[model samples]
Target chain A: MTAGPVLKGAADRVLAAPAAPRRKGHPGAYLRWLLLFAGGLIMVAPLVWMLSASFKFSYELYDLNLIPVEPTLRNYEKVLGDPRFLRWFGNSFLIATIVTMSNLFFDSLVGYTLCKFRFPGRTLIFIAILSTLMIPTEMLVIPWYVMSQKFGWLDSYWGIMFPGMMTAFGTFLMKQFFESVPDDFLEAARIDGLNEFQIWWSVAMPLVRPALAALAIFVFLGNWTAFLWPLIVTNSVEMYTIPVGLKTFAVEQNVDWEMVMTGAAIATLPTLVIFLIFQRFIIRGVVMAGLKG
Target chain B: MADLALHGLTKTFGKTKVLHGIDLAVQDGEFVVFVGPSGCGKSTTLRIIAGLEDATAGTVEIGGRVVNNLEPKDRDIAMVFQNYALYPHMTVRKNIGFGLRTSRLSRAEKAARIAEVAGVLGMTDLLDRRPSQLSGGQRQRVAIGRAMVRDPKVFLFDEPLSNLDAQLRTQMRLEIKKLHKQVGTTIIFVTHDQVEAMTLADRIVIMKDGVIQQVGTPSEVFNAPANVFVARFIGAPAMNLLPGSWREGGVALDMGGQIALPGRQLADGTRVDLGIRPTDLAISADGAGQITGAITLVEPLGAESMLYIDAGGVEIIAACPGRTAPDPGQQIRLSADPEALHLFDATTGEALR
Candidate 1:
C-alpha cells in the first residue's frame, strides 16, 4: 500500500477550497434582472392589492397589511348584488363594445380611402385627421359637451359612445398599416374584377387583421375606462358607466375603499380578458408597426 | 388571344415627364418585351396598359375596344408582378382561383380552372402550400399560374423573374416562354435584362430616358442598330468603338491606318466612330492585316477567349476561339469583317451608313 506521497498530494489538493480566484456575477446583468423583477412586482402589486381588497370587509381595508387578516366576500357581494352596479356594468360593456366595433369599421373605411384612392383633397383630409391626434381630449371637452347637449343626447348611450367612436388614432394606425401593404396586391385584386369596396372589404381588411385587433383593444380600453367625458355628459343614474357609478359610492362623510376597489377590479377585467384573447395579434401588430415605422 | 395597342401613350409625374408619347401594337399571341435601364419608364408604360396608373394622355385598346376609362379588371387582362404578389395567407390553389371565384364562376368551375392552371405550371403538389412555405421558384410558378387561370385577353408581366436566383431565373425564363407558346396569349414583358429581352421577345422595344430608342428583332437590333445607343446597349461585352476620320472613301484610324469601304462615302475630314462587336474581330497569325496591337489582357472563357488588345490608342476587345491562346504583351493583328462594321457620326451618335 504505497499510497503515501501521491495519494496524500491528491487528497490535499482535492480538500483545498477556492484554489482559483472566484469570479463575481456581472453587475450589469444582476442589475437588469433586479430592475425587471422590480418592474414586475410594481406592475402586479396594484392588481394584487385591488383583488385582495375586493375580497375583504371594510374593517380589513384600514388594517394596511399585504395579506388580509380575515378574508371575506362581503365587498364583492355588496358590489355585485346592487342593481345599480349591475346596470352600470352592462351599460359600460355595451357602450365599449359598440364603440370598438364602429371604430374598427369606420376607421378602416376612412383609412382605406386615404391610403389607396386618388381623389382630390385626399392628402389634405389625411393631414387634417392626423392633426387631430395632437389636440387633447381636455381641449375639446367643452365643445363635445355642448354638442352632446345640443343633440339632446345627455345621459344617453350615444352621448358617451359618440365622441369615443371613430378615433383619429384608429384611422391613423390603419392608414399606416394599409400603406405598407404592397400596391401590387391591391392591383392584382382589382384586375381580378374586385371593385374598390370589395377590394377594401375582402382583401385589405383581412390582411390588416392584426391592426384591426389592436385598434379594437385600444378603443375598447379607452371607452371602458373613460371618466371625464362620461362624467360630464351622463346625469342620470341609469345611464351611468362603471366609473361614474363608482363615484356615487364616494362621499364626504365616508369613502368606501372596498367598494371602490371592487368597481375598479370589475372595470379592469374586460380589458384584461380582451388582451388575453387577442394578445398574440396585439404583440404582432405592435412589432410590425414598430418595424415599418 | 387579343391584340393590344398603345396609341400615343404618355405619362408625366408633376412636371417631369416620365414617358414621352409612344406607340406600339402587340399582335395576338405575340410576346413583346420592353427593355431599358432604370427610369426608362418601361414599368410605367406596362402599368398604364394594365390600368393601374392612368396615362396623362393616350388611349389603350385591347381586343379592338378602347379601354381608356375602364378599370384594370374591365380590360380583361392579368399581370404577374416582380415580387410575385401572391396573397400570403392564401394557398396556391386559392391564389390561382381568386380571380375566377370573384367572377360569376361556380365552385366546380373554379376548382377545375385551378387544377388546369396548376397542371400547366407543374404546381399540382404545391397547390395546398402557402406562399411563405414555397420556394422562390415555386412562388413564381404560382404567380404565373394565377395569371394563367384568368385566361385574360392579354398577359402583362412586370419583371416576374427578376427576383429569382440566376439559375432559377434562367429556368423560369424558359418556363414562361414555353407557357406563352402553349397558352398562345399576348404577353407584354418589362425587364432591364437585355438577355431576357433578346431571348423572349418577338419584338424588342429598346427605351432610354423615357423614350423609345428602337424597335426591332434581336438580330436586327444587333446587326442594324438605329443609333449608337442601340448598338452599345444590345450586345454583351458591348461594341468596340474606335475614333477615326473619313479619308479617301475609307475610314482612317488616328493611329496611322486605313480600311477601305466600298459603298460608304462620307465628307472628307468628317470624324466618325467605328463600332465592331467582340465576336466580329478575327485574330489571324499573319501580322500583315488591317490593325496590329499588343494584347494587354486575355480572359479565357471555356468556349471563347476575350482578348483586350491595345490598338490605335484605344483598347479593343476581341472574342476569339478558345483553341488559340495568346499571352499577355503578345503583338496581335486583328481584322474585322468590313460588312459587319458599324459607323456612327461622332457628333450625333447616329448611324452613318
Candidate 2:
C-alpha cells in the first residue's frame, strides 16, 4: 500500500515538472497513440474471439458474444482425448522440432561457408538461393510430391518436412550475421589449434546467437502452422499435421466449430510460448535489419 | 625460442600482387617489427609466417622446420590482433586458456597455466572478469596473456597497439617490450608507426609498395637512411629535400646558390637530391649556410619547433628552437652540418654514398 502511494507521488511530480521537455514538443502525440491503440485492437480481435470461442459450446459459437454466456471445458476435453487429434499434434510436434534443428545447423553452416570462404561462384550460389524465395510455393508442390513419391517418403514425416528443413530465408539471415564475425576471431581460433569445423561451432556460433534464435523461432512457427502442403502430400489421416488435422474437423454438413477452435487454440500455444521466450532476439534482429536497410 | 626465416615469400590477389617475394631472417628471441604505409604488405608477410595465409611462392621456416603447408595451429605460432580478439563470452581466464583446450594437460594443470600466464601479465586479479568488463589496456594484456600461455615457437603481432589511444599506445608499447624480455620468444610485430618500430624492435623492416626498402636498427635507419623514401619515412617532420646538381667539391643548387663540401666531389652537373633531416637542418640568424628561405609556418612540438620555409620557390621543413619560433613569412637562412647531409641519386632515389 505504501509502495502504491510512492509510485503515484513520483508520477505526479513527473507530470507536474515544468522542466519536462516532452511537454513543450511532441504535438498530436495522444492522437498517434489513439490511432495505434485502435489499429492494435482491430488486429487482435480475431485471435481474442477465437480464444473465447474455444471455451464455448458448439451451439453458442455463433452468438457473437466476446465471452460465453456459459463457459464449458468440454471442447478441450474432446480435442485432448481423441486419439486421432493426439496423433496429429504429435506429428506436428515431431516435424517442427526436427525441421527447426536441421534449419539451424545446415542453414548456419552453409551461411558461414558462403560468407567466410573465398570460392568461385559464391555470389552466384547466394543469388540462386535467394531467388528460390521468390518462387511461389504452389509451383513447387508438384515437384516435391513427385520427389516424395519416388523416394517413398509419402504418408510419412519426411514428406511434410523435406521442403522446409533448410530455408533460403534462414540461410540468408544467418549469412548476414556470420559475415560480421571478424576474420581475426576465426584466425585466432585456428591459431588456437581449432580446425575449421570446430572454429565454426565454437567461435562463430556463439557470436551469432541472436540470429540463430530468431531463425529457429521463425522456422518452427512456419512448419507448425503449415497447411496446404501437408494436406496435399499426406494420404493418411494419422500423418496429418495440426493445421491439416484442424481442417479435418470441418465437415461439409456438420462442422464442429467448438472442436476446430479448440484445436486452433492448442496449436497457437507453442508459438506464443516461443515468441515470449525469444522476443528480445527477434526484435533486435528486425531493428538491425531495419538500420542496415 | 626459435629463429624464423622467410625465403622468397610472395603473395598475389587475382590481378593485384600484394607481396613481391619477401625474404628475412629473425634471430632466436629477437623482436622484429615490420613498418610501412598502408597496402605495403607488411601485415600480409607476417600472416604468411603465422600460416594464417598461404604464400604464393615461398617457404617459411620456424625453428629449422619448413611450415609451408602446416595449418596455423601446427605451425606453433600465436597472434595478437589489432582489435584484441578475446572471446567476449568467456572470462579472461577462459579466453587465455582457450588454446590449452586442445592440449593434453589435465584440468588442474590448465588452471595452473592460466594462473601462471595471468600472473606474468600482471593481470591475475582480472582473470575472473570478462573481456567487456575490462579497460582497453587490460584487454590488451589479456590478449598478450592468451598468446603467452600457448608457449608457441613465435608470437606474431598485427598492428596490435594501433587500436589503443596515443597515451595508452605508448604505455602498451613499453609493456610489450618488457613482456618480450620476460618471455624471450621470437616475435614478429607489424605496424605502420615508425615510432613503434623504433621503440620496440631489435630490427625494423621498412617496406613500401610490396617491397622491403631497408632493414636496420633504430639508430642506423634514422642516421644512415638507405634511400630518399627511407630517409623521409623513418623520422617525424620528415627529411628536407633540396634540388641541386653535383659538381667538383660542391653542389650547385637550383636556387642560384652552391653548398660547399671541401673533400667530396662528384661528376660535374650530375643531378642529385640533397637530403637533410629536419633536426640537422635548422633556422640560422647568422648566415651560416647558403640556403635561404621565408618561413611559411611554425609547428611547436614543445621540445622543438618545426619551420616550414620556402627556399628557392620550394617549401622545405627546417628545425628551430622551441622557445624561438620564427614568425610566418619572415626571411631566414637554412643551415646544416656537411657531415649530416644525405645525397641521393635524382633518377633512382638511391642514396649516393
Candidate 3:
C-alpha cells in the first residue's frame, strides 16, 4: 500500500520555503522627509531671526540674515538696566506660577470628582464646563473684565490670574487621564485604609502625572506670554507683565529694533526652561489624548 | 480573624438586581469560596463584604458588628482584585507597605512587616521591582503579599487566580491554600472555575443567576448536588442527563428504555430527567446491561477515553479504559448501578430525593 498522491502534494506545499522580503526606502519616503524638514525650518525661522537681531547692531536688523556678523551684548545691557524690566519679569513669573498651581489643584480635583464619583447632575455639570470651551477667549474677556471691575480687582494680580486659575480644557484633560487609572486601584486603596482625599492625592494623582505636567507647562506658557487682558486691565507700568511691558517699551523707544529683539530673546528663556523640563511628558500626553480622542 | 455574616444582602444597579437577598454565615478562620459563571453576582457579594460596594438591603456583620455604613477603609478588611491592581509607579515593597502608611505602626515595624510578607510569599528578591517588570504569576504573588501585609479581619479574593495561565493557576491555588493554612484568617474567595472551588474551599457556595443554589463541603456537593445545574456544573465532562417520565418502580426513558430505581417513591407518570456521571457507567463484556448503544465517537484523555454512544436518538457519554475503547460504529453495552442515578424534575430541573 502507498501513501496517497494528494497527501504528498499537501506535505510538499506545506514544507515549501517562504518568499523574498520587500526592499526598503521608496521615493515617497524621501518626499515625506523633505517636506517635514522644510516645514520645521519654516516654523523655526522667526525664532532664529529674533536671536540674531538681538545680537547684531540696529543697522543689520533688516538684512534677513540668521547669523550676526558681529554679535554684541550692549542691547542686553540696555534692556536689563531698565529697573521696570526686572519688575515686569517678576510679575509675570508670579502670576504664571500662582495660576498653574491653582489650575493643578482645582482642575484635577474637579476632574477626579467628575470621573470617579457617581452623582446626579454629573453629566449636566460636565456639559456645562464643555460648553464653555466652545466660547472663544476673546468673548469671555468682556465678562471677565466687568466682573473684575465689579469686585474692585482691576489693576491687580488677582484680576489677571483669576480667569485662568481653573481651565475647562485642563479639567477635561485630567478627567480623560483619570479614566485610565482603573477603579480597581481606587477600591484597593480604599480597602487599604486610605481616606477619600488621601486616595485622590496619592493614588489617583500620581497616576495622572503626565497630564498634570502637560497642564502645568501649558498654563505656565499661556500666562507667561499673556498680553491682551493684562494690557487692558493694568493702568500702571508697575503692574504690567512681560508681554505688556515689552509692548510699552517698544512703543516708548519708537521701535528700537535691537532693544526690543533683545527683550524678546530674554523673555523666551523661562518658557524654554519649562519645555526642556517637561518635553517628554508633553509629547506623551499629546499622543495619549490623540489616541483617546 | 473574624466571623463574617450577611443578612438578606441584595444589590441593585439601576433596577437590574445583581444579588437577590444573599444570606450566609462564615465561621472565623474558615475558607469559603463562591463559585459561579460570569455576571452571577458572586463578586458583587464579595465586594459587599469588603465594603467596596453597598448592599441595597440588609447588613454585613464583621465579627458581630454591622458594617453597612462603614467605609471600606474602616471595615477592617482587605481584598485581592482579579487584575492584581498593583500600583505601576511603586515597587513591590512599596505596594505592600502602602496599606500601612496610615497605620499607627512605627516605620521600623511597618518595614519589618513588609519584609515578613515578602519572605512568606518567597518574593524578597522581587521586592525592588515594579509591577510592570514582573510576570503574571509574580504580580499575582505581589497582590497577595500586599493583602497579607495588612492582616485584616477578612481577606476577600475576587477571582485572583483567574488572570494566571492554567499551570500557574494550579500552582497559585495551592499557594493560596497553603497561605490560608499558615495564617488561618477568614477568607471569602470567588471564582468561576469549579475545580478551584473544589480543591481550595472548606465549603463551596454554588450560585446561579443571582441566587446561591447550594452551600456544602466539596465532597458533599460532589456526592449529592442540590439540583441539575449543580450536577452538571461540579464535575468534569458534566453529568449526562436523559429526559424521561417516572413510573412507580422505574423510569421510562424518553429514548426507549426503562431504568429500575429500586428505592424511589416517586409518583407514577411523573416527568423527570435522569442523570448519570460518565465515570459511573462501565462497558459490559457479556452484552447484557441496562443500556446498549452504537459508538459514535471516542475522545482519548490519556488514562481514560470518553465514548459517545447513541441509543435510539439520544447521545450519551461514558468513560472506558483508553487502551480498550471500542471503535466508532461498534455496538457497546454500558451498565450503571441504580444508586448512582439522579432524578430531577423535568420542568423545574430540581433534583428529586
TM-score of each: 0.91, 0.92, 0.92
lDDT tens string, model 3, A154-177?
A: 999999888999999888878877
Clashing pairs in 1: none
Return the top candidate by DockQ: 2
Q: Local error of candidate 2 at A56, Å?
A: 2.4
Which candidate, 2 or 3, would have the higher DockQ against the true structure? Answer: 2
DockQ for every model, please: 0.27, 0.35, 0.33
Top lDDT hit: 3
| Deviating ranges (above 4 Å) for candidate 1 | A1-43, A252-254, A276-293
Best to worst by DockQ, what's the order? 2, 3, 1
Q: How would the docking of model 2 be graded?
A: acceptable
Tens digits of lDDT, candidate 1, A1-293: 01122223333444444355544597876887799999999999999998888878887786668678888877888889999999999999899999999999999999888988888999899899989989999999999999988889888999988887798888887887787677788888888888888888877787777688888888888888899999999999999999989998886368998899988888788889998998765665555445444
Assess the local accuracy of residue B191 in candidate 2 as a C-alpha lDDT between 0 and 100.
96
Clash-forming residue pairs, model 3: none
Chain A TM-score across all models, in listed order: 0.86, 0.88, 0.88
